[model samples]
Target: MRKVVGIFFLLFSLSGVTEVKDAHSASHTSVLLQSAYESVEPGRSFNIAFTITPKEGWYTYWENPGDSGAKNIFEWTVPEGVTVSAAAYEAPKRIPYTGLMTYGYKRPSTVLFTVDIMSNYTAKSLPISLEAEWLVCEEECIPQYGSFKLNIPVEKAIPNEAAADTIASFSTHQPEISWWDSRLIINDTSSALTIEMSEEEIKDYTEAYFFPKEDGVFTYSAPQTVVGMAEGLVLNAERSNSLNKPEQVTGILFLKTAKGDHQYFYLAPTLETPTIPKLSQMEDPIEMQSFPLWQALLFAFLGGALLNLMPCVFPVLSLKAFAFVSAGSLSKADRHKEGWAYTSGILASFLAIAVVLIALRSGGDALGWGFQLQEPRFVGLMVIILTLVAMSLAGIFNIQTGFEGAGQTLTQKSGAKGAFFTGVLATLVATPCTVPLMAPAIGYALTQDSITLTITLMMLGLGLASPFLLLSYSDTLASKMPRPGPWMEKVKQGLSFPMILTALWLATVYGDQTGQLVHLFAFVTFVAFLIWLREQMSSPLKRILILGVTLAFSAWFLGVSEKAPDRALSDQPSTSNVWTEQAVSNLRAEGKPVFVYFTADWCITCKVNEKVALQRTETEDMFKRNAIVVLKSDETAGFTPDTLKVLKKYGRAGIPLYLYYPKDGSEARLLPSVITIDILKEYIEGKGV
Candidate 1:
């Protein structure tokens, strides 16, 4: 009966969607699967798109989702004589929150995969099976399982007009190698590289991203850029602070261009060159190896330390420690028991998080942190929780759980439980705090063996819970607390300020994730509901009713609502253009100066550059004065054909790249991924209009 009631309440609480399980849909729900194919021959690669439309608010994972979530499972049941390789993915955007990360498509995103069918395979009917597993979500995420079996015929003659049109469209969008200046000059002494190009290719390109083929060489986000004389660009790549000089610097060069993205690959053999320029060259492609294990563990430890400082953990940890310290008459042994209990709580929470993450990863989520909070409804729920905590601390209500004979109320008798629960709550709240200190550690942990992974997570938990543990286990610490007095009330009320502050921060985050209007509406509703709940009798039935109301509101606000707003470029220019190497080359060939910026939508360095350099008034003015074209190539989706071309041409693949081209048809000059006002001025002055 209770289960039935819960189910009924869940069904009744839903908004913005309806579920139908008809006889036909019992075996398979109404799923829209769109498939398109292209041919890959010399100078061209085929682009294919397999779109699976879920019943809205459903998703699939990327290659990695840190901590919790399932990986998107796909099986190919192909027809005879047809060989297919894994589809290359466009670089993905990173979303970080708190301590957890997940990577996947947020909206009704189409998964684009490519196929290289030999010319001989044309005109043949291809039998294929597309078996996929994904997570369909609207609050409570559900795993979806299905397989698509279809026989698509291949044409022997030239592709039909409609097919040709579709193929052409996909091909145009496919990633390809673009124009790169063939000359590369590397200064090992100063750790700099310069490439000369036409001045007209880029105007005042900034915010460049570079993907170094070799790891531990150049740091991911620290290249200094300078525009040199004539049509050339110079890059001063600082050697990794932790290591000596690398044998060679290789990767993709992503720059900004007017036509959208200006992406190129640069693979130049390490050469000792003086002041004169060196001719650039490309080499056979090499695949990168995964990061080693010990390093991953170390990263996890560091990440764990940083997690303690996160908004969620900070409040909870501080409160828990204060609670322990306030528990005056407790013995040392009693305090130790509380410490163990708190540890147990934290460990249990970690286990649950791990299970959820692993399940979602198995189902195919991507590498984003705190993605569960992406919905406004969830954020609303968190706000409600924080508000309740603040109200409770302010003595707005009394919560008693039996134990009347023991003369201890629920909040006093279970200080240990409170501390432990605090740990769990901290984990729940800190999902949006992904930072550089935590990413590599969590990222590496995700790819590790479960034992190692669990240990790493536990270490993180320990780090976050350390303060509470120490406080709980130390009677001496408890003795240090001020004797129970009027000052205690002042401190309690003061602590509520943090809660209020946290609530405000969450509301703002929620607003940023959704629209300001949605946040405002949600806040008004939440405040009104809280006031009403406070007015109602605090009876058992009323408490249950309030819980139901809270859950219902959360579901509606987070689960049934639209996706979060993209706050990446709230202050940036138009996003219509995607830079490509071919486009950059074409602009340069057209005798136009070009400014190329290579960056990932998720890269902090890239974001900073976008704000300070490219978007600056002076930069824009200089670009206009020089009649320079602006281009932005994104590497967040990995390497596209256009991205690959740019990477190969420039002999690079890492991000935060910048390049410049004069109006001449000569090679492009490599600029530093990092830039300053003086650097920009020098480049503009060197290449006179």
Candidate 2:
């Protein structure tokens, strides 16, 4: 911690002098090379970013510069043994000039690439030489071209915080993703190339535009309708303006999120239909689904209301309870104001998560609710957060909002902010668990229009916040609270137990996600040592040293750890069969009823339903009596693309998906997300409740 604080302060000292030199040709547009690190470490991979900023009203084109602008071209002259990757193009913002609509940046944007250094190169100074050219236009196009150089002294220096901040700001130009899918509709008259994905993928934008990779394939300025479909969302693009079509269409789809977050999608749709082996997928592609908006709203509200009871949310409930109890001295109006603020914070967080979800999903990233929990890195971070929160609650730290120390009194405004922060924390912790009511609503929200999605999420937030809001505004509830004193301190300290438990749980989850008990537990021990070291230290220097080492170690570990080895299906129920379409086919050929379960270790609901339904003796007997075959797939520690493909085939984004296939050769039935023993029995009986 002491070392970390020292480095932080050192970086802060350098912030003023971190010079960035821009290479400009006549000032219409400027290009700059900025190092994201203080020094280029030997044999380490780091980023050297290119920032393209156009003067007011002028713009530079993207790689696929729409109808006519020239794409930016860059060449580098580097020392031998150095490997530089191709540029990671930032999503281009729309640049409309004259009568033509072009694609590129009108403001500042960045393109980053990784530079790998060779171990053999031990030089003190390494020169970075580069030449770049691009077409910039306001009314008329100007071909701006230039050469630039930077001499980077090789050293084992830390990351540059200022350059990092700049990189981060420019990095938003990176694309947000959703799953990638091309839905082709074949009819007698003509075939339409439809791209179907989650509506949340592009829900933020009011306009839909496509820039084809191959020229003459798509009409550059032609309008495309972004509509919500049953499968999720689709961009029904207009054909070429010249009535000409390419054999295949491929390019980038750009959308500015409701929050002004730019997202890009690299769409490459095959001219023909796709085939997934071992799966008989959904057949229809063009019949766009129009789910009624009212049903989604109702489900969303119900799901949010039930979210409070989830394990992911329970640990944070104490904080909201404490906030409510702490509000005893405040007047009714003040309490009401705090409640509104708290509610707003939750709604804001949900909205932000929605925007992020849409962006990433649109970018072809396989993401969903509880996705962070699926990541070992995220689980590790949660461990750190819970540990610090435990320490704060146990009186180890006097954390405050804009206040100096314990001697200072907190104003009502700060108190309200704390309440708001607690609400935010509650929503964050609640994300990992798909409780009974929330699964449908969360699933539904991802498919709706932005307004509907936001409204749906707001309903969810209201449900989560409603109970506390009621308490916040209630004078009667406040009257029931014991006064804040020594007991309050004791209660706060006691609250630390749950936080520690949560930290432990998160640590265990990290192990589960990685399937490396040794490494994860060792990592946890290191973190524990740091926490203990902080408590034992009176000298601030020693504390920072431990904190810095721990953090740096964590950063290094997450950066280079190999993927976790695959987990076997040995722990599955003895009666449960291994899941495979071939197995199902064989069983059905033999006239046996089959029940298929799709699950993952990261899914808490999967474990619960596994214990409550499939593992039950009565359920087993019912299955046996009906001669049923139970098949389960555990997609926990490795890349099981087949599992993911099967999941997608079932119209599911993630796990705990249950399907019942009767031997009668009837259509398969989808079991509810939260299935009861009775429901499972009815499903086996071929009559769903």
Whole-model lDDT for model 2 versus the true structure? Answer: 0.66
Q: What is the TM-score of each candidate against the true structure?
A: 0.44, 0.53
Best by TM-score: 2
lDDT of 2 by residue, 162-265 (tens): 67766887666566553667644322223344556565553545445556656544444433444545464455433322234455666666655546455677
Q: Which regions in candidate 2 have their CA more than 4 angstroms from the true location?
A: 1-289, 394-414, 448-459, 535-550, 560-562, 567-576, 638-653, 686-689
Reference-based lDDT, residue 267, model 1: 40
lDDT of 2 at 513: 67
Cα miss at 488, model 2 (Å)? 2.6
- Give the alpha-carbon lDDT of every model: 0.52, 0.66
Per-residue CA lDDT of model 1 for 1-689, tens digit only, reads 54554344334323212111001121112333333432123222343444434455444444443223565666776544455566433333233222123344544344455545554554445555565566654334566554454444454223323334434443443334534553333333234554554455434453344444444443332333434335445555443223445565544455655444545444453445555332222232121112445555666556656666644556665566455545655567666766776677777877776776677767854333454554556666777777767765665643331111111333334756665666667777555454334555565466545665567667666765666666676666678865545555556656667877677766765555555545555654675465557457658777677767766666665555454434476454765455765687567667788888876533434555677777899888888988988888754433345654554334342345677765653234565445665566555545321
